[model samples]
Target: MLDKIYVIDTNVLLQDPKAIYSFQHNEVIIPAVVLEEVDSKKRYMDEVGRNARHVSKLIDSMRGKGKLHEGVALENGGMLRVELNHRSFQYLQDKFVEKTNDNRIIAVALNLLLEEQTKENGRQVILVSKDALVRVKADALGIPAEDFLSDRVVEFNQIYTGYQERFVSSEVLTGFYKNNGIPIETLQCGILYPNQYVILKDTLRKSVSAVGKVDRSRSFLKKCAFDNEHVWGITARNVQQRMALDLLLRRDISLVTMVGKAGTGKTLLAMAAGLMQTEDLNNYKKLLIARPIVPVGKDIGYLPGEKDEKLKPWMQPIYDNLEYLFNVKKSAELDKILAGISSIQVEALTYIRGRSLPEQYIVIDEAQNLTKHEVKTILTRVGEGSKIVMLGDPKQIDHPYLDEYNNGLTYVVEKFKDQQVSGHVKLEKGERSQLAQLAADIL
Candidate 1:
């Protein structure tokens, strides 16, 4: 039985160009208007444009298999077809105009629905779109509509937090603190991933507590190497922060992801760690910091200056952190200090593509604004002996098409949590100030 027919929108294809074969053993339709929109975006240079071009190539390849106006057999045993000549304006119940792309797509679905009524057991025609407005309009017209789920993390809150609290007997706590390294498998807390942090608390003695991270190589729980170490006069305020610091300082871990809300010290801590590893320890050749040019509010328009000078405003937050770390008070002093330090480089993410970076400590701040493809592109730029840290608050995404579930930072944390070379920590407490913490909580 042909149980379902998926009418995919242009946004869905742009989001994931290989969506043509995702519906296993079901029929997939690309509305006529969607091709027009995809063709218009093929000449662009961004990720969306790249995906549009890829979709066009994919459709073109399928044309040799069979007529696209009829259908072609997908490798996944599904039928793929390009919808044409069913964009009737009179099919819509609403007063939707004809020239609009969204309305034309809806008309194609309406025609499909009407044709299905003549069959005894018609397949359910579901409109799959990434645009929420299109889904809402389809629902008003009694067509089933849903979001494309190829990259979405269902129930994103359930993702790994990277920290766990376990209550233990005072004897176990004593053993952990006395030996400084206990077999984590003996704790009987089930399986633990590499670099996962655990907090031990005494049930009888409420004040007694200890913190350790999982050492998978030795099958033990060991104390953090830099637990008491300070990075640029900054120390870890909590256990999660302590875990983050450990991950940052470790040479074996190449990728680290930190997620938290505002005032959680995510940015400040990452920058501090980057400076320590780059300037003090000489572990890396340089400290390269970049972020997507996402506007927090209204964009201030383009600034008139050289590339470095124009990047000053976009990277001012990083400069602010540097000044705080170096105990500088003014931008002039900070600029003077930065000019003297040849190891520090601040640039926008736009210029980072197709470049090789080796022996560097890279921090991509506000990384949640990046798409998964953008993240992959940035990561592929890393040369040998480089560590990349992604820092962001999933809840504060600024990209119009991204959210907590599908953004680059969240994607990295979820996809790499199981790797031995990757470490993640989701900081919860805000250390900016009491007032800022309260605002983050109640606001």
Candidate 2:
């Protein structure tokens, strides 16, 4: 077999450092300009920055084996080398030569191609990049270029986070009421995961009824299980109270993604579930929750105080849910719950890079703000025995270059629909209040 050489672009490493080893036994080359690009992004205090630091640590760890400029032996029996060819582009100067980083990376590929042309071994050198324009430019230069395929594109409509609603016959509806509930065997035929919401319909009357999630044991358990149930001395209204209990008490579906407008109990339900599962049931080790700090078009820098204070505004929704779940009237009381429970953690998505999490229940709220690439990076970090739930409303995306159809939350739902390990639900009805539902529908 002929040895294949893969020239990796900087974006690929920043997206995933382990991408170097994903090519199997093939030789991986890192253009020197790519390293410079990676160095520039290392100072960022975001997810990208953490990934940059991780890649640097990975390369630094390889120094004991050999010099990186030459080549380092990967665990998968592949070679990774940092190419130091500082070539210039006179032809590109006529089109675009402002000493841009993109041009510098392209120049390295051109140099490698020219060097390969004279070799008697005649190995194939492919330019692997995550940037679409760079690959187009490489193709124009008569060089082989392709997108990083290890991450693989997911279909737009197949991903399943495990929530669905189906219409059933009046007879089936009667059976649910007569039997006190439907049978597990009958429900299993249609397929269901824990924490999935289903709407039972009366086909004859054309009316519908909502059903809370059920356990794997087919027990009709409430979803969110709150201990005290009063927040700031205000108890949840009858329906809100029931919905909250439904989310917290259920144990079948490990991952639950809830999407709804404000006041719709999305975050509240998730937090309630985390509290019951972690503090009460002790089913999981800890409750690890995170959300992207990217707020609309503006960055986190515009906020005051340190990273934690600046993150507070974005994390307030999480705290609100926590405060309500703990039934704390005072701010200090809420702090005590956080202080007492070492198992419950609220963190930013920025710090999640390169960490392998296990035996924890993770909830990522407002996931619609994340890009497809960013979501993939977060999901790949899940370790064994961990169930990660992502909740967000696609209609309320705040990230640039992301829309309802292309955001990470929707992307996950469409890509994992067939897989039994994941499930998704789109909360259509806003259970907050009559006014809130009206507002969600009209305004």
The CA lDDT at 86 in model 1 is: 72
Q: Write the per-residue lDDT of candidate 1 for residues 340-420, one digit (tens) a residue.
A: 999999989999877999999999999999988899999999989999999998888877667788888888888887789
At residue 94, candidate 1 shows an lDDT of 55
Against the correct fold, how does model 1 do in TM-score? Answer: 0.95
lDDT of 2: 0.71
**Residue range 299-352, candidate 2, lDDT tens digits:** 546777897777788888888877767777887798887888899999999888
TM-score for each candidate, following the candidate numbering:
0.95, 0.60
The prediction achieving the highest TM-score against the true structure is 1
What is the alpha-carbon lDDT for the whole of candidate 1? Answer: 0.87
- Return the TM-score for candidate 2, rounded to 2 decimals: 0.60
Residue 361, candidate 2: C-alpha displacement in angstroms:
13
